[model samples]
Target: MDVVLASSPVDGDVGCWDLQTGAEQMRYRSCASAPHGLASVAGRFLASSQVGNSSSGSILYWSWHKPQVEIKSFPVEPIVSLVSDPDGSFLLGGGSSGNIYIWEIGSGKLLRKWQGHYLAVSCLLFLDNSLIASGSDDGCVRVWNLVSIFGERDNERMKDPFLFSFQEHALRITDIVSGFGSSNSILISSSEDRTCKVWSLSKGKQIRLITFPCIINAIALDPGEDVFYAGGRDGKIYLAALNATCPSNGKFDEYIITCLNEHSKAVTCLEITKDGLSLVSGSDDGTVRVWDIKSQRVIRVLKLRDGPVSNILLVQLPNSTSNLERVAKLPSLDKNLDPTGTLTAIRISPLNGPPDFGYCSSRLMLNAIKELKQRSSVGAMEMELDRLREEQRVCAQLLQRRKKLFDDLWRARIDTLLDDDQ
Candidate 1:
């Protein structure tokens, strides 16, 4: 079953509903989620970055079965945008101080952190598994390589981790979404400047500029990438053509095909279903509307007593057994970046080589993996062979242990037979 999640900045709970049946699910509690802060962590559980009442910012984790918060993490700085990688190996947070932090999922250890924008980051997106794109309140969109982010780098590279920076947006970027591709993906960003710009990642330049009738707060690209849906502050969802050719008449209607105008207030967020048959949008009027994309009509409406919806996530629900197991195994997010423990020296180089002391084991392993990527093919192959040999030796030792246990059992059976004969 597919689930649609919506949250408001003023509300304390994150509302969830079955996308197909329109039945309300367990509402995750105590989350004043910021815009672009709600996420499904590997589809295991729900996580949201809170706009707390206190000065400090916190992240809350919720189990699928329970409504209350299961875990909470307070970061050093208030994080406005949060996202997990495709694999859920790492959780990334864009801080209010313009810093971006990455934390290892299992260990809950902060791996690497750097300031990417001059102003606060408004949105964070993983273009793919390796590349992450961050849009800031300063009207800049920057892309960073995950491998290079964790690897050992010189001062120049460390100071600026972004591979490409696009500063064409005249105002703060409200939302960003990437189209389907690996290195050649297209990114569409909506800004407060009343426009949405399409950028090509491979070419590192803007490919199309689309002017909107109002300030667009959210953007969702069509599955075919032929068009995109932009939610505007004027309570309208405009359908803009992406690859469709149109005359450059310098008019807003030239690029816009149609619009859904049922929203009573400003549209806050928009998400298209995986099959591209339905478009789900949340609005400031505290209602979630489901639209049939083909018919361009409202099919379902969900009401929330809370304030305006700020975030929306569409995800598949897991089976009961798996959901229970996941909830039981979910780790508590650590508030501290560095856990209090004895320091362990780790080797980032070859096996049994000199230790690269003064770092956490998880981070050291990441650095080692990065080093392997930088090494020559032959050296990396040799290391792989050595690792396989070690695994083989361990398997042989386990076999011997099993054989010894069988031999002991046989001898005991023989003694019992001899005693019975006497």
Candidate 2:
């Protein structure tokens, strides 16, 4: 039952296709759909965000094998992005007013609402069950620690409120994806600035910034985390290096090794499969294309009349054990996606210990030494402060005694002057 689901640009007509065969399954009439605003709600249903000229922003859920919306809810503001937890327990919506709204999937109840960005939230995704990665129009990609944001906070000062805020993109952020680098530390972000940047979480900085000939709207990572594909307005998909920290053998850091020439217009959304073998890309041309990653060529194309394909999803359901027989199966990947084409892939590599702050060992040691020295001097400084306070108290007492003595002496002088006058 694995299928590729997509929405049309006009009035939200949803269509499904068999992933393995590229055969069209069924078509559903969408009430409406936003750009990059579709997400598969587990394997049971699909969720999409829609904002039309006459209708308010709403989230609509569609059941499999049906063309009508199953459930729908309206939010206060126009929702631009949507995502749900892996278990389908909660769904999150990014609004135009810079707020993120979470709702319970079963009951459609509002779970919590918090401000996630300034101006507007352009993209969002669940890095895992615990972390939510968001990209904003403010030109930043931020990682929100779900545990800290929703868990206990009894005076723990939130250091760097966001798990991490990537400020590499100077212009409005078009898309951001993780799971490309290790430990969710690595991130890929595209912008209207015509650049796609690769970040290292273990390194905590921009490992490489690949500039494209046109503005990049969407990005997808290679399965091995070695290369990433960027879809730009120029109708070209470029492959950029990920692990190349510096230049290779004196040459410039391999920016774009190759390009996939396909769509004639801007590429809006991109999705790679769990096996990392194939990729699905949607464009403004109202077509969905599946390409073999190794071949770097389009193998099948599902042309649609939906103005343009706003968002795409490759849904892979977990296999259930059979009582009759047990067979070999492929491993599921740690993949990430957004409701919109502005994707944020989150693949958190197994962190052996604590989080890496991307600081050099030597610099960290120096800071540790300085911190120890400061810690050791704290007691001495506290004592010195106490001594200063005691000295000030003693001076105040001495001044009080002198004032009393002067007053008494003045009174005696006045009495002697009065006697002389009599």
Candidate 3:
């Protein structure tokens, strides 16, 4: 897999590195200001934000294959973070001025602007195709229904439709992540207040809040969405299960958490691949470590010669037919299943080799297989449920026709008997 690492130096130049070879591939010095946030779409294009004395920041897009060419550059003001839509059609950027702008990815055209936050928006997450959650520095998180905003406009423009907002922290929200389990729409946000809060999108309320020893630097969810791993400035990583209950409005319960103090420096970035076998973490210690999530141990540590690893991205290696083959071998759904029913079985393949029963095996291939199984089971169940619903509708129509025919025949016999009596 190709890994792209971007870092913004204090000198106002953006440095791009190829993680696989540990080589500095390209450097762009457009804005004379320091960059703060970096975001990428499809691994082909990246957007880096410049934040310094310049009141207006700019986003620089670079070609992933040939990092020398500048694909596009657009100007934005007080930009805090940038995020691309799931399909990469639009790029959403939040600014310190409490304005969010959506731009066409390819053209860099301003599509719409969302204004709702009372303070600077720090983090943004696309909950689904038509919903976005934005957390502000004002300690409030707002959920926006993008469908309602777009549906009301005739010109395909988006207006602000703040579905709900919650003030759970006394400080800025640093990170936000959307989970991928049966409770799909759950969102977790980490703040400078040394706490992580879980919010339910369906209910539009805070469900749980987890406190930490120090400021939480980064947070990541397991592929199963059942567990959460949070890294803190205290150089420790904490693992907590989502099923554990906590103090809602008042009551305290079992919110057990396991802490691992392996890193000597603050963990800056954490990413889990689509196949949940391995997790990679980048830290301020200038090292990137790949961890076996099942064993909760670091397997490989890739040391860097330059500055600290600020970010780490895992891209699927091109021409890797094995990954595709593993995905194709997933099981099909049964004919009888509810479309909305939760998935029961998840087959996890090994990461380095073939499928195995042992946990934390070095086989990447096996881990991929297991991850594929989980995804396929859920998808197949949904498909089967849809098919069954259509069949049920057809059968109901046939039964209704048969009942009508029987009623008509009985009525005809009664009329004939009455006529004979007369």
State each model's CA lDDT, in order.
Answer: 0.79, 0.68, 0.60
Residue-level lDDT of model 2, residues 1-422, one tens digit each, is 67887886578578788988888877878655766578876554677888787535777766565677665666777888888787665678887877766664433345455676775788887766666778888888887755455442321234455656888788888887888322434678888888887765544457677877788889998778888888888788877777664344432235677778889888888999888999899998888899998888899899775578878888863343221011111111111221222112111122485322121222343455567567787755554564466569756855664564355446546755776799
- Weakest 10 consecutive residues of candidate 3 by summed lDDT: 328-337
Would you estimate the TM-scores of all the predictions? Answer: 0.79, 0.70, 0.65
- Candidate 1, residue 216: Cα displacement in angstroms equals 0.4
Clashes (N, CA, C under 3 Å) per candidate = 0, 11, 17
For candidate 1, what is the TM-score? 0.79
Runs of candidate 2 with Cα error greater than 4 angstroms are 152-160, 180-184, 245-253, 317-422
- Scored by Cα lDDT, where does model 1 land? 0.79
Per-residue lDDT tens digits for candidate 3, residues 40-65, read 65443555655666566556564444
Off by over 4 Å in 1: 153-157, 246-253, 323-331, 334-422
Rank by lDDT, descending?
1, 2, 3
Better of 1 and 3 by lDDT: 1
The best candidate by lDDT is 1
Provide the lDDT at 37 for model 2: 76
Error of 2 at 105 (Å): 1.6
**Candidate 2 lDDT score at position 402:** 53
